[model samples]
Target: MAVDPRGADLARLISEDPGGPVVMLNLLRFAPDGAAAYQEYSRRAAEFLHKYGGRVLYGGQGSTALVAETGQAWDAVLVVWYPSRDAFSSMVADPGYLEITSLRTQALSEAVLQATVPWPGFGES
Candidate 1:
């Protein structure tokens, strides 16, 4: 499973900009002994996120699913909010941030990263 985004994927993410903040939904499946590595990645990533006007809205280990497909269970879930799509793009493109990406790659056996849009009448805006 590929954890790192490709150049084309980044390009597409930027091109499809809806012009506002974006919440990234991350579903991660950790490799053996990967949790500790991911924790280190998170610690370092927090700084870059702050620099880019982003933050982790929520993060937690996955639990037993009440409802889901056979292969839909994830080991962890994270929701990161960026001030804008461009902010997220810039963060990922930063040289310093790029150097730390290997930690995330090494920590995950599989991952899903998706940009989420807020809907009307949702929980907090």
Candidate 2:
């Protein structure tokens, strides 16, 4: 039932940074009547995302999983790219951004926010 990141999580993200940009993978599960609330949160968050050099590469509703565990199917998925971990940290820490996070917190029953690094195939340069 973890909807948001904590100080320790952010610190670890920084310490573990291998450098360069990072893409965040978000797997969201909504509470009852939560989808509308989450959509509002996303709308309000757009400006901040723009301010911090981040963008949502994809956002879509999740459906019955063709292959997965019983509880593995999520309500939605979002893939966001940020210039760096620091940018993400700063954006989340922003006073304005913090004010509106309640919407997201109240909306999600659970979530998975992960930093994913691109795997460069050998000889791709």
Best-performing candidate as measured by lDDT: 2
RMSD of each: 1.2, 1.8
* Deviating ranges (above 4 Å) for candidate 2: 122-125
Worst 10 residues of 2 by lDDT: 116-125
Model 1: lDDT to the true structure:
0.93
Question: TM-score of each candidate?
Answer: 0.95, 0.95
Pairs with steric clashes in candidate 1:
none
lDDT of 2 at 89: 97
Model 1 poorest 10 in a row by lDDT: 116-125
For model 1, how does the per-residue alpha-carbon lDDT over 1-125 read when each residue is reduced to its tens digit? 78888989989998998888999999999989999999999999999999999988899999998899998899999999999989998999999999999999999999999998888799775
Candidate 2, residues 1-51, lDDT tens digits: the string is 789999999999999999999999999999999999999999999999999
